[model samples]
Target: MDYKLIDNTEGKQYEYHIDGVIAKIEYIRAKDKIYLTHTEVPKELEGQGVASALVKDVLNDIEKKELTLIPMCPFVASYIKRHPDWKKLVLKGINIA
Candidate 1:
C-alpha cells in the first residue's frame, strides 16, 4: 500500500492517514534520543499494514536525521527485531526487549 508519513513536530508524533483513520507513532525527544513511546492504529486500519508502514517511515526519518531511538513501544521493538537493519537506530545502552 502507498503511504505518506508526516512528522508533526508540534504534536510530537508521526502520523499517516488511511481509509479515513489516522495511525500514529508518538514520541518524546530528549537530548539526542527520541523515545518511541506508543503506536496506535485505528481498528479499521488494522491488518492493512498501516502500523508497519508508519513505523518504517518513522525509522527512516530518524535515520535521515542521524538521531538515536529508544523504541519503548512493543510494536516498534518487534519491528526492529524483525528488521535488524533498523536496530542500528536504537540508542546506545538502551534495551527494549
Candidate 2:
C-alpha cells in the first residue's frame, strides 16, 4: 500500500489519510526539537502497517529538517528500536526503550 504522510503543523500532528480515516502522530515542538507524544490509527485501519509507514515518514522528515526527536510515544519509540538508523535523530539524553 502507498501511504501518504503530511505534517499538519496547525494540528500539531502528522497525519495519514487512508480509506477516509486518519492515522496520526501527535507531537509538541520546542525550539529545534519535537516530542512525539502519541500515535493513533483507527481501529479499522490497525495492523495494516499504517503506523509503521507514518513513523518512517515522520522520522525521515525529522532527519531532512535537521530536527531532534524526543519520542515520548511508545509506538514511535518501538519503531526507533527496530530501525536503529533513526537513533541518530533522537535528542541527546533521551533513550528509546
Candidate 3:
C-alpha cells in the first residue's frame, strides 16, 4: 500500500495505490483557510479505510503548515465534527452558508 498527497493546483488530494490500482482520491483547497471539498474511493477500495487515511494525511499537512481549515465537503465536515481535536485548526470567520 502506498499513499501520497498531491496538490492539483486548485487544492490538494490524497492518492493511494494498492496492488497497482489507484484506489482513492480526495480534493482539498486552501484559501483564506483550507477546505477539503471532495473525496472518492473506488468501490474496490471501500471499507479499506483509504478515505480516512487520505483525510488524515491532508489534515496533517494542514497542521504542519499552520493553516486553518474549513471542511466544505460533507464527508470532511463530518470528519471534522467527529474529531474535536482538529477544531482548533478550523478557520475563523468562514462563511459556508
User: TM-score-based ranking, best first?
Assistant: 2, 1, 3
Clashes of 1: 0
Query: Compared with the true structure, what per-residue lDDT tens digits does model 3 show for residues 1-97?
Result: 3377665554346566665666434544545566666778778878978887777777887798787887777776677777768777877765333
TM-score of each: 0.93, 0.96, 0.73
lDDT per residue as tens, model 1, 1-97: 7788989999999999777778999999987889999999998887988899889999999999888999899999999989988879997776657
Which candidate has the highest TM-score of all?
Answer: 2
Clashes of each: 0, 0, 0
What overall lDDT goes with each candidate model?
0.89, 0.93, 0.68
| Model 2 agreement with the true structure over 1-97: per-residue lDDT tens digits | 7787889999999999888899999999999999999999999998889999999999999889899999999999999999998999998878787
Tell me the deviation in Å of residue 70 in model 1: 0.5
Ranked candidates, highest lDDT first:
2, 1, 3
lDDT for model 1, on a 0 to 1 scale? 0.89
lDDT of 1 at 89: 91
Q: Pick the candidate with the highest lDDT.
A: 2
